[model samples]
Target: MSRLDITHERASYQAVFALDVITAAGALIFLGLASKPTFQRIKQRRFTAPNSKNNSARDGPLKTTLGTYLFLWPALLCLFIAYVCRLVSDLLKTAGTINYDDDLGWNGRRAYSTADSGYASNISALTFTTALATIFFTVLLNGGVWIHSSHVQENGTGISTPRTKSRIWNSAIMLAMLGTGLAAWGLGIHARDVSTGSSGPHALLSWSTVLQHHRATRIMYIVHEAIVVAASLSVSIEVLREYATTNRNARDSPERKDLLRFAFAVVPLIWLRDIFILYDVVLLYVDTAGWSATAVDATTLLLVVCRQLANLAILGMVLWGAWRMSRSVALFGRSYYA
Candidate 1:
């Protein structure tokens, strides 16, 4: 069969394309709104004296600033690019010109795969970079949440504690950096393999199959998710602490409320995505004993749609929280809220 003699699930791709449009639009709007505050924070940091009291890092603690927490700008931008790429890739797939794999493609579609198709290799490269972008976004945001909570706790207390550095927190950050690097390395290997036609029988969109077959990528994915879950859990604890300490009637209550929203609403969704990932792995690789073929297909479709929807929801919540925090900064110039 010719490479172009491929069939695709038109309705499935159409649904995904629609989702991509909505997510891309939301990400664009977020970027536009975030640019001002993000830049203003940068400008403020440049002009302000390093020794100034406003410099939270001057004494001993990590510097907490709007820029530090507003990683949502780049995060959203990454997702936007990823979504747009997906849209384009879907279009290509519909035209039966992009590479596909019989073993990995949806519904056993026969087509050229990553091992043969240039377009497929390039798409794999894009997927690697975008996945790294997402990992960075989550890790950075989680760290920011923790550090911001620490700042809140320190400043909220009128008493001056010792100016000693937090060796423990510093060590944790370093370890997380190490893990992120390892994850990147693993993902890079996977991408390189795909591009060089070494990753056998891989399809452009066969993420679950890739994980199941590629040991390095699979291990690193688990590591990456573990790091995310750990960081998110820390943030959850810190947010709870903020809620316990913060006075509802206080001036900085809005900041507390925003954190609450992040913890209660956004964090849970992140956990949910991770759960879906774990379940996807289980259904795809682990628990396939007596499942009917129809049941397996249904589960696959359900996981694909639900996982993407979960991701979209997480992106929306994080963007909304960041926007709320940015607005708080606009109203009260570099206060703890920002």
Candidate 2:
């Protein structure tokens, strides 16, 4: 590598490392904030009688929404894992624990070289975690909101029925499961890439590579993203429909509305990340040959920043929305309620 190339490569790695550190910290903060209400609710449930009159008025309707709060945690956890994997990948690569092969580079002396084995496996793990977080976070957030709104609506009318499990909710659930399965299957296919050796740059840490250079890996991610997009679109429509149909004068209407609005905010962020992923795949195929080291480095850092920040924003919204839902007027028996 020339002097300029060396400088660019070092700068790129440092920037990514710093980004991972910051993003991980943010994810931890969000996780802690989001879990506060969940833990408090758990404690309250332990101490209070489920049938007690005092608890009944406060907990009755909101208990139905507990699943919403609970569901948010797993998504947050998945995100945390995803970022942690990125951090670890960067650490190992920098530490020389993971071997990078130069011959696999499309651009001579690229920053993200193809890893031989262990590094490739780390990349696969990162993809798996990212896939899980991306697929399920959108699903759970919207699904929880849908289910909570359904219960709130049913409760308002004093009629609880199986119809609360509406077709839209069912479809969302099915799609989410299918997306997750595809992601796992993709990860499995990626294992083949890992063991046989990576064919292209392993920018999994930068969110700039998703096995796209490999035919099977490319198809896997495209299909997975499509499935997630479908699920998110359906749930978003349902949530919007509920928002319109919900009576403004109803007691829980504002809570439902606020939650739906949060969902609206999050879905677009998900799509934005999806778009970033697409750009990365395109970059790989178009060939980064003749691209300057600085250009490659800058591109990697840009994608990392955009994708991680989007994830942080999504987690923050979930924290706020879950906190609001848990502390709503209809739900009581927690310290906040007291």
Per-residue lDDT tens digits of candidate 1, residues 199-313?
Answer: 3444443343355456677666666666666656555665665556554423354545655675677666666766665664444334353556555555555665555556566
* TM, every model: 0.67, 0.67
**Clashing residue pairs, candidate 2?**
none
lDDT of 2 by residue, 222-277 (tens): 56655655655565565555544444434354444554565578667766766775
| RMSD in Å for all candidates | 6.5, 6.7
Best candidate (score: lDDT): 2
> Number of clashing residue pairs in every model?
0, 0
Candidate 1 has its poorest 10 consecutive residues by lDDT at 102-111
